[model samples]
Target: MPKPLPLFTGLSAFPLTPADEAGRVDTDALQALLARIIDGKANSIGLLGSTGVYAYLTREERRRAISAAVEAVSGKLPIIAGIGAIRTDAVQALARDAAEAGADALLLAPVSYTPLTEEEAYQHYATVAATTDLPLCIYNNPSTTHFSFSEDLLARLSKIGTIKAVKMPVAKDLAFAAEITSLREKAKEDFAIGYSGDWHAGSALLAGADAWFSVVGGLLPHPAAALTKAALAGNEAETARIYAMFEPLWVLFRAHGSLRVIYAAANLLGLTKARPPRPILPLPDTLLPEIEKAIAALPER
Candidate 1:
């Protein structure tokens, strides 16, 4: 079968594929988690996102996780595989692996290392785009990779035939708005635009982002999906209600940290037992009650 196109609407959650205590990927748990998201009617599931600990995983491990996720999904929903590495060869390998493993599209990002010139960054994506037939989405998160795609770069990247979207972690609203407008004018007809910063999700959508990439949705797919639907439907009342309920959790995530806070919240919700991989420590005990309280306050399904 041909690779699926990038999904640009509705809620797409970046889930942390559960791993066993032995550090082996628990395929069964991965499938089960995906099944829950699918059954919950989420629009899409993003595998190997930052929360998936993609950087910590070896190429082989990521292959296994993507294969298991694709098998579990069985085409029920679109799967966007995260393909990011510091080296061009490694990124190409991951993209090739995802295409072979039945992933629908790729969420490509710059590898964490010394920053690249805009020309080098553009070439990095162009090379990957040439390597994989599947549609590609550039991941822009300066906080993690220390590289942000400028409007000029994004406008140029939009001209590539295979690059169909961008996942920008909007660090500044004014800058993001300008970039979005420029991208819309430059991108292909099918190009999708999205923002990853939860703080800016609502505003991003309001400012014309086609969809959102949310880590919160990974923990509470049902509620998050509901909120997105509400937002898209322009149900201000419902959107406000859900946002209010989930705002506390978002606040904690922003305050504590990104991947770390997400893993802690997942553990609190009984989703996984695995801690953040080496070099990154687990959440402190002092934060448990606060997390629990925030979760408990979420509106009932």
Candidate 2:
């Protein structure tokens, strides 16, 4: 078996932060969602991710969500809090709040209204990483953040002692193995490399990426965990078998964003009834039947 990657590896399940229309986190509903992740034995709980509506929340509300997660999991699994903001100072303060609220790690994206230069991005990470002792994962999500990390910038950020891992976007043509190898060469020794983009996560893990910072794993962890276990063990046949089960859901995720699909899934699963924060609307009622079929296809416990 391959050695397990430390701290940030494996199935880091990203749960949505259930909240009211006012952006106030519903701690009760939030805790309920976390209970599922804990029961599924996910490796970690990623609170306030993009799927969690981190960008839509106020700092007070974000802190409340982190506090609720810490209370819900009770340390059964690590909590990696997302603290991305458009300003470096805000990110620093958010990092402090996460550490104070008992988060096990931090996830930062270079969120910007004005697109940032590489040096600006590096400095932003460096500054925030300096603010707290908590280990930070660089969130390389260009699709939403509009700021991409060049390999050189990633390598530079990896050298920051507190910046321990990277949550990378899916590679083009699914070239995860080559990208992982090239990234590992320049990154500091044991600096972990993980991928997002749930549909391609099994392939990335099979190709030797350290982790799956997953969106789907949040709502459907049983099969997600199964896929992670098989792929991490280099069991390609088993991984392929389990991954095939998620095909319908992945198609929905691609057609309508994963964020919208997951919110709808959470409601259908009776996990939470919170809608996506506005200007981002819920998936149409027409899609519910397909989502139910997708959910029914997965293993139940």
Candidate 3:
């Protein structure tokens, strides 16, 4: 049998960080979002993640978001805070801020304007790992961060004491079993492996992935958690049934990107009036009907 997973495992919901044009986090709106995720029975909260617009917020705002989430969660679930930044010192400071604000774990992406070498990435993670006792999850999001962690680099970083997990992007072929097995072969024992592509979540979980670092789960946690439960239990029929309900939204996510689609879905659900940060336009009103139709596909429980 597989070794027991650690704290960052399971359906970790990544909520949007509601903020105004000035980038100040709307703490009340954020707390309301958290309430829904907690009520939906998600295993953990991934705050200030890519969905949460961590790269767009000021450090002060990030700290406020963490504190508000900690208060809202109140020990109910683990809070994994995203601390990605272009500069090493900035990431270190953000990691410190996350720890001070009661975050349960740290998620770091190798954010850089210029491409980072594998050695640079490894040292960056090593330095940040030493800065906080909080367990760290490597956020291997090359599309946004412009840096990819090599398997060798990943194996190297996994040996770091505080680096306990990795949030992987989807494999090119979606062959999650081969990918997980390959990564696990060199990773430290109990180093939890999870995937973040919302569309591939069910397949990843069914393939023995330890967690689903989900984007859709942030808003639609009920169905996402339900799908997670079914997949992790190895119930393919039920997983496929629940996954089909998500197919419509997945189509939209593929077409318009999960960030914009989710923002649209949240508004359509009347969950929030806030839009994505400026320069990231909200989906046009024309898509609302389709979004509504997709949301209607879920179980509504």
Candidate 4:
């Protein structure tokens, strides 16, 4: 039998997938990145996630990346691999591939080109959950998938035994706090809620989110962990101090989505040569100075 599922809590490092100048997966560089994440003391390592650029890779390449990551981790940190695809069958196949590659759990997004109904979305997850015994974390990223799960849909999905967690998107409004509190109350007692909006992670934690499925945390694991540790400990002074260091990076993220900013950060930090997948190329030359300045501005811990 596979290992028991890990509780969805604490910081999870989501490093951008490393690719060479030619856009091929760089296994050596990826391994180094995974080792660094473990060293930073993150609770888990999330691969093929939004930050991992899974939607851009060929199936064979994704499988190889998982194998390499599993080998590199060597059980140092639990690996939660994304298995999302537009079609249900395709998602199931990816989930199987991830399990065979030794991933501990699956992170799924209900991706669709045509709009998906709440019923369709729920069934998509229900079918996928039935296909595997491995725990699944439903990824509700409306910005990318353009399909947001309603509170009722989420409640229904949580009843699925293998559906262990949800990667929630925080609304960018003053009511964000109330939204998290209400969602947490509506979710199953045992179900874990993880927040993905990097900017909202601190507030989400304070509002009782169980985990931070973070992009910035993936690369800047030490400070990310420090921020999360502070929140969990209720140390507002420490939290504010650490969050201030990320203001420069947050500016870039707000301008361009996290993937672009993270690739720039990874390159600046010498962690990887991770250019965003084609069609989502590197931020233009005009942004290079900003990326440099943002990284340079990072406080010396």
Candidate 5:
């Protein structure tokens, strides 16, 4: 395969898919949300990521979301479509659809249910990489995928020529930092690594992560973009200032039973409707005050 496009750098936000009370994908809400992000000057938009509830969406729904985003964005910023599935065929289909939808790249996670041998995993990515002309960003969220990509596996994947980036979300701060350092040293010059775990965003940038994919970015694009700019510009003082402001929101995301906290935050900012799809409950009425307090405390852009 031809070499993948260079890894996308800078801040990318993963916005959730807002649904209506009838449990349907709300296109108007989605277009409105994308407009908000673009108007906020977000560097890029990553849809169908974990925040978008990709696993729960049907193939058609996923395609609709990508198409809506592509139309709404209208080339204002590159769209990184999340093409994750437990089956290779499903992933390749999603990738092809995303490329046709005009996405700049695809964020692919390993097969979810069965743990594949390293070689199997390699072939899985290679298959999708070959099937789509879009660049690929290997998403490593072992917490959800139940398996981490070993350094050897990553090193080998980097050589595929179509794998241009890795989004490493190792939970441990030190280990995440070390992996970014080592990956930067060993990977090919064009392959960039991104950090997705919000807690380590500041440190990861300092350690040479090319960019960050922020869940918080969906709720507060201005601050997240500011934080990324500050870090990239070597303005540690500004980075720290923005990070301190974002700390509470990050803490809420970490607290148990807080997916709703995130959803609520997004709603409060008018990024999306507060309701998650069925099976995932909305935030309790009691938590609204706490969510509001955190939002109110956020520093102004």
Candidate 6:
């Protein structure tokens, strides 16, 4: 029998949306940046993910961004739209707009102001699933969402008819690899486990992650693919070499947030001159030299 397909596998490039100083979406810049990502050979495009600052934008802004992204790619790739919201009704509406805008799939995190019970979380997902037939990827980023998903919760989520994968935030080399195992035991065999710890991607992907839902991939898709390919091929030497090149940027990501660092890197690389959301400011000028040095090390191919 043929092997089953991987969950959101390959390099799912997570793009940082470009906007002007006025905080308006720069459709021209967005289009240019997306074209570069596609040219870089990503398997799919991750639009409006955490890296995109989905939480801070208004509902209408979110919709317009999706429309621009859908139009920009022109169906050249499958756009995985992040529709994470604290309210189910908002998430459902976002899901509708995503579908209408031609997104290939939806990703949601259980973003809540107040604490949520496991049942409440499950119901939120189930309710959103009912809004669209687009396959859902459960985004388990406790760092931003402030809610951690237990294995039991993952198991229940896996059973949702429309849910196909889980974007589990990981710590790179060690614990992330174990999460793939533990999550599998709790979830179904098909529930694809994707990781987003940019620092240790090589070790995690080599260890058996289904997808490298990456920030670096969006910035430098070609080199990121080279690394992921090396890891997938079990070519440890190549993977290690490429990962080392990324070490400096990863250090910055650890110090500041990847969201801010990536925006700065994008600006430095001439990809997006736009800054991140209000509270999440640009990488400090003092850090620019370091970021520039790190970016210079990224292999173009």
lDDT of each: 0.81, 0.91, 0.92, 0.83, 0.78, 0.84
Which tens-of-lDDT digit does each residue in 1-301 have in candidate 3?
Answer: 4463456778999999988888989999899999999999999999999999999999999999999999999999899999999899999999999999999999998989888889889999999999989999999998898787888789889989999899999987999999899999999887899999998999999999999999989998999999999999999999999999999999999999999998888888887888999999999999999999999898666
What TM-score, over all chains together, does every model reach? Answer: 0.93, 0.98, 0.98, 0.93, 0.93, 0.95
Q: Which sections of candidate 1 miss by over 4 Å? A: 1-6, 20-23, 174-179
Pairs that collide in candidate 6 are none
Model 5: colliding residue pairs: none
lDDT of 4 by residue, 1-301 (tens): 3222454788988887787655578999899988878888888888999889888887777898899999999998889999888889998899889999999888999989999999999999999998878888999998889997888889899889899888988765745568767766776777778888887788777766778898987877878898889887878787788788888888889999889888877787777766887788887778878888877766433
Q: Could you give candidate 5's per-residue lDDT for residues 16-88 as a string of tens digits?
A: 7776655467777788877767766667787888888777787888888899999999989888889999899
Inter-residue clash pairs, candidate 3: none
In model 3, state the lDDT of residue 180: 91
Report the Cα lDDT for candidate 5. Answer: 0.78
lDDT per residue for candidate 6 within 1-301, as digits (tens), equals 3221443887889988777665678877777878888999887888889987788777887888889999989978888999999889999999999999889999898999998888899999999998999989999988887898888999988888789888877753477667777777787777777778787778788888888889988878988988889998989999999888889888898998888888888888877678887866676799899999988988787
What lDDT tens digits, residue by residue, belong to model 1 across residues 71-113?
8899999999999999999999999999999999999888757
Judge candidate 4 at residue 87 and give its lDDT.
86
Instruction: Provide the lowest-lDDT 10-residue window in model 4.
Output: 1-10
RMSD of each: 2.8, 1.7, 1.2, 2.8, 2.5, 1.8
Question: What alpha-carbon RMSD in Å does predicted model 2 have with respect to the real structure?
Answer: 1.7
Q: What residue runs in model 2 are displaced by over 4 Å at the alpha carbon?
A: 1-5
Q: How many steric overlaps are in each model, in order?
A: 0, 0, 0, 1, 0, 0
Q: Which model scores highest in lDDT?
A: 3
| Model 5 lowest lDDT segment of ten | 1-10
Which is the better candidate, 2 or 3, if ranked by lDDT? 3
lDDT of candidate 1 vs native?
Answer: 0.81
| Count: clashes, candidate 3 | 0
